[model samples]
Target chain A: MDSKKGMKRREFLKKAGVTAVAASTAFAAPNVHAKTKTYKWKMVTTWPPHFPVLGEGADDLAKWITEMSDGRLKVSVYGAGELVPAMQAFDAVSQGMVEMGHASSYYWAGKSPATQFFSAVPFGMNAQQLNSWIYQGGGQALWDELYAQFNLKPFLSGNTGVQMGGWFNKEIKSLDDIKGLKMRIPGLGGKVIAKAGGTVVLSAGGEVYTNLERGVIDATEWVGPYHDYKMGFYKVAKFYYYPGWHEAGSSTELFVNKSKFESLPADLKAIVESACARANISMLTHFESQNNKYLQKLVNEHHVKLKKFPDDVIEKFRTLSAEVIGEIVEKDPMSKKVYESYSAFKKDITQWAKLSEATFYDMNK
Target chain B: MDSKKGMKRREFLKKAGVTAVAASTAFAAPNVHAKTKTYKWKMVTTWPPHFPVLGEGADDLAKWITEMSDGRLKVSVYGAGELVPAMQAFDAVSQGMVEMGHASSYYWAGKSPATQFFSAVPFGMNAQQLNSWIYQGGGQALWDELYAQFNLKPFLSGNTGVQMGGWFNKEIKSLDDIKGLKMRIPGLGGKVIAKAGGTVVLSAGGEVYTNLERGVIDATEWVGPYHDYKMGFYKVAKFYYYPGWHEAGSSTELFVNKSKFESLPADLKAIVESACARANISMLTHFESQNNKYLQKLVNEHHVKLKKFPDDVIEKFRTLSAEVIGEIVEKDPMSKKVYESYSAFKKDITQWAKLSEATFYDMNK
Candidate 1:
C-alpha cells in the first residue's frame, strides 16, 4: 500500500463524513432503527484515482449505491496503490481486507485461468453478446461458482466496447511482421504474441508510453480510441491497427466480500446490485459516445495512420488464440467448464449477429 | 379504460399489499420517520400483462425500485387497457392519472413527431450507438426538454437490439417488388412503406396473424425472431427478411409524471432512475440471448425461408425514409432540434463502428 495515497483517500472519506461503524448493528433489530443504520464500507479498485471511464465507473457505482441507499450504505472508493496494490484488489476483497473491489477479471488469471472467460476471450463475443451471455445465457452461474471459491461475489460493472488492436511503430502486413516484435500486451493476447515469435514485454500503464517512446516495446495495446488518444499513443507510435481480436469487448467487474455482502439487508443488497447494473451500461455508453470523436481527432488532427491487421495475420493470431485458450482449458477443469458454456453461446450468437447486427451495418453502409 | 382489466389489476395490487399513500408525507419532517415513509406509485405500460421482455422489463423495474427502497416506494404495474388504452399511457402519466408509464417513445408520435428520434428512425443508430447518444451525448437534455412539455420525465428503460425486416409472403428482389405491397407496419417504417408504393395497413398485434393469413396484408414487421416466432409469423409468411432498416434498435422509455417525480425524496428518485438503467441492459440481453435459439427453430424446425431485402429496395426505402423525416423536421422545430443531435451522433458513431464493430465482425467470421 502507498501511504500518501492511502492517507489522501482516508482524508477524502473523512471529509465525506464516513465513519467506521459496527457491521453487526445493521442486523441488530429488524424494527428498531435498523433501516436507518448507516454502514460505511471501503471499495478498492485496480485503476489510478479517478482514471477516466474505468475508475470513474467505480466512483459512480459507489455513489449510486450510497445515493440509492440514502447514505444507509456509504461506500468510500480507493484507487490502485491507495489502500493496496492494483494486483491485490481481488485478494484484498476476498480476504475481507476491503468490503469491495473493482477490476477486470483477466487480471486474476494467475489465481484461476477460468477468470479470463469472465472478462474477455480472444475472438470471443463483444459487449452486447457478452452481456447477453452473462445476464441471461447461464454465464453468471459459472461466474458465481468460480468466484465463490475466493469468498467473493462478482458483478459485471463496466465494459470498453470493441477495442483497437494496438499502436504499432511498424505496419503489420503479415505474420512475418509479428516476428521479433517487442510489444506490451497482457493476458491471453500477450501469450499469443509470445507464441508468434514476438517478445511480450510486460509494462505498467504509466510505463507504456515511455517504453514505446524509448523503443523498449515496439507496440502496445491500450483501450479504444478515446483512451488511446488520451494516452497520447499516437505521438509515440505511427500506425494504429483495428479489430482488437485479442480483446473484443473486455468487461470490468465489481467483486464484494461474500460474508460482508451476505450480512447486508435485502434492500442494501438490491441497491448494490442495481448500482452495478447501472454502472455496466453507463461505462459502455461513456466509451461509445466519445470514441468516435477522439478517433476523428487522432486521424485528422494527430495524423495517426489508421490500419487494419491483414487477413492472414488476423487468421494466424486467431489460430494461436485458440491454441492458447485450449491449453489452459485442458489443464484446468474449471476453465474447461466455463469455456464450454462461453464457446457454445458464442457459436450460436455469432450466427444470429450475422443476420442482425452485421447485416444491419452492411445495409446502413 | 377497460373496467374488467382495471378491476383485475387493482385486485392484484391489493393482493400485493400496495395501498395509496399520501406523497406529501415523504417530504415532511426530514429527520423523523421520513426515511420509513412508503410511496405507492402506479406504472401504466403499453403492453399486455407480463408480456415477454417489454412488459417483464417494466415488472422488473418496479420490483427493483421496491426492493432497493426497502418497500419505501412500492410500484404497481398495469398492462395496456387496464387503466387506460395503450396509446393513452403518455396522457395518463402527463395528466398525473398515473405516476409512471412504460412504452416506446415512437408510440407517442401523434403527440409530437420529435418523439420518433428518441425511439428509432429509419437507418438510425442501433442499440449501442443510441444508448451512447442518450446517456453520454447531449441527447438526454433534448429529450428532457421535449418531455417537459408534456409534464413528464423520460428515461431510456429498454431496447430490443436489431429487429428482422418483416415476414413477407412474396420475395422482394428489386425496388419494383415493393410496389403495391400491403404491409402492416407502424410509425416511421409504415410511412416509408407507404411512400414506396405500398399500402400501410394499420393492424393491431392480435389482428396481424389473421390479416396476413387471409391475404389482406402481404407483409408485416414485428420484433425479431424470438417474439415473431412466438407470434407464429412463420406459419403465415414464408419469407422472413433480414436487417430491419426502419426500426434499427427501438428504445422503450419509462416516463414519470413531472409533479409526482419532483415530489419524491432524493433517495427514491435515485432508486427509480437506477432501476430504469438496470432494466435497459436487462431487456437487450434477454432479447439477444433468446433470439438465436428461436431463429434456429424458425429456420430449421419450421422450415421458414429467411431472406434479405434487395439492395435496390433497401436503398429506395432509405431514400424515402430520409424524405419522410425531412418533411417532419421541416414542419416541426422540436423535431429539427432533436434530429440535428441524433443525426450528427449517428454519423460520427457510424464511422467508429465501421472500424471497430463492423470490422471486428468481419475478422471474427
Candidate 2:
C-alpha cells in the first residue's frame, strides 16, 4: 500500500509504448503505421495487483486497447495502492491524475449514493438484466449524468455475474442463525447484513480468509467459485451458500477523465469505448467459464458443501433489503430517482425472464 | 429476393468513402487525418432488410467497424435478398463474393453439421452459458477450425437470449395434447417436436402468422416476446408457452471470408473482431430490453395468455430432445464431437449455475 511502490508515470508509459509498438510492428520494425500518433494513458484500479477476475480484467482491458489500436493508444494499468490507492481511484480520475480508473461504483457511495445503483443492490437485477438496463435502457445516461457532476465519465466495463451468498463456517438454517453472525461484506450489502442483526466486519482482502478461518469472522462472500476457490475459502468454511442476495450482479465501472476523454481523436476514442465493452463481455464469460470449472474442483476435490440459504432466511433478507432500499431512497433524491428507474426495469425484465429464462431453468431442473 | 435489388460494389464504395470523408472533416474540410486509406467491405445477412435485432445488428456492426477504424475499414451491410438470397449468404461470404456475412450458424448446418452447435441446440446453454463456452472455453477456436475448412472465419456476433417455446391456440395440457398438432418450428427443435408426435410444419417467416391464424399451423415459436409480439402471434394464439425448450439461446455468427479477413491491416482486423463482440453484447441487451416491454404489451393490450408448458409436456419434450440430439450425434461424427464438448461444458456450467444463478432465481421468486 506504499506510495513508494508506485511505478513512475514515465517508466510506465515507456514500457507500455514499447510493448505495444513492438507487437504491432512485428512484420516490419520501421512500419509507418506504427509511427502514427501514440497516446500514453494510465489506468488505476481498485483491485490488488493481479487480483482474480477484477484486477486481471483491467490488465486485459489495457492490453486489448493497445493491441486493437495498433499502438495508437498505450494504456498502462496500476493496481490498487500502485497509484493513488484503491478507494481514491475516483478522485484521482476526477482530478485528471490518471486518465482512467477501474473500480466498482459502490465504492464511492458516500460521494454520490446514486452511484451504488451502478454497482449493485440487494435483490437487484442479475448481470443480464443489469446489462439490459444499463446498455439498452436509460441507466447509462443517468450514470453518466451522475458522474459528470464529479467530472468523470463512467462505462460499465466488467461484471462478476451473480455472486455467491458467502462462505459460512456453520450452516445458516434459519433467520435466527444470522442474528449474531459476523461476516465480511462491503457497501450496501454490509448495511443490509447489519440491519438483519449480523455483525458487519470489514476485513482487507488478504485477511478475509484467515479471519473466517480463525473464527474472527464467521462468514464471507468474496465472489463466486473461481475467486473464492483461489482465495481458499473452502479451507475454512464448510458451507457455501447461494443467491448472493446482497450484490446480485456486481458491475465494475471504468472511469475516464471527462476532459481527457474528450481530447482523444475520434478513432482513439472509439478504441477506448470498444475496448471497455470487449472487457465487459470478457469478464462475464471468464467468470462463468472459470467458476464452473473451479466449482467442480472445489466440491469434488476440496469437499466443500454447497448450500442454499433457507427459504425463511431469504425471506427475511428480502424484506430487510426492501427496507434498506426504501431508506436510501427516502434520504436522497438522486438515490430515489435511480432506485425507481432500476426497480421499474427489474420489474419488467423479471416478467420477461419468468416466461423465458426462469421457466427454462425451472423445467430443466 | 431478386438479384436486381442488390447495390453495385463500386457505388456502395463511393458512398461509404464520401460519408466518412464528410463526417471526419466537418470541423476542417481539408483535414489530412480524414484521408486515411479506406477499405470498403460488404457484409450480407440472412434477415430481410431492416429486420429487428438480427438485420439491424449487422448494420450496427458495420457502423461500429467504420467508426472504430477511422475510415481505414468501411463496411456496408446488405440484408437477405439484397446482395444474395437468405440461404445463399454463407456461400457468398465463403466464395469471397462478399467480404462478410451475418447469419445463424445453424443455417449452414447442411454444409457442416457441426455449425449448428455454434447457434444453439435443443435444451442447450442459454446466452450466458454459450458465451462462456465460445469465448473462454475454446469453443471459438473449434469454430474457427471448422469454418477455416470452408474458407471462412466466424465470430459470434449476436444472441437472442432464451426463445419462447411457441404459441398454441389450445393449451398443451399433457403429452397427448401435442399429438397430431402442427407447429412451425425449425432446426433440431422441429425434429424433437416431430418425435413427440406433433406434425412439424416448416413455414417461411412471413407466412408463419397467417399459417397459425388459419390453423395451417396450430402453434409456433418465432423468438422471444419482442419478435413474437411483432409477428402478432398474440392475436391468433390463446396461450404463449415458454422456456423455449428448443433453442434456449440462439446466437448469430459473422462469417468473414478468410482471405479477405487476412488481407486487412492488423488494426482493421482488430476493429472487425472488436465490433463483432460489441454487437454480441448489444443484441442480448436489446433483446432483454425489448422483450420485456413487448411481453407486457402482448399480455395487456392484446389479451394473450402467458403460459408455461405443463410439467408433463416439458418432461416429454426434454426426453424427446435428448433422443433428437442423440440421433444427430449418431449420424454425424463432427456433430458428435461438438455435442460431446457442448454437453460436457453444459453439465459443468449447469452445476455452477445451480449454485449461483439458478439458486438465486429460485430464492428470489
Cα-based RMSD of the predictions, in order?
A: 6.4, 7.1
TM-score of each: 0.92, 0.89
Number of the top DockQ candidate: 1
i-RMS for every candidate (Å) is 8.0, 9.6
| DockQ of candidate 2 (2 decimals) | 0.35
User: Clash number for every model?
Assistant: 0, 0
- Fnat per candidate: 0.65, 0.59
**Candidate 1: which stretches are off by over 4 Å?**
A1-32, B1-32
DockQ of each: 0.40, 0.35
Q: lDDT, candidate 1, residue B332?
A: 98
Cα lDDT tens digits for candidate 2, A109-153: 889889999988988988888999999989999998899998998
In the range B1-365, model 1's lDDT, one tens digit per residue, is 22343355446545654442222133211222346345678999999889888999999999998888877677999999899988899999999988999999999999999999998899998999999999999999999999999999999999999999999999898877878999999999999998888899998788999999999999999999999988999999999998899888999999999988898889999999999999999999999999999999999999999998877788888899999999999999999999999999999888889988898777655
The lDDT per prediction is 0.88, 0.83
Off by over 4 Å in 2: A1-35, B1-37
Return the top candidate by TM-score.
1
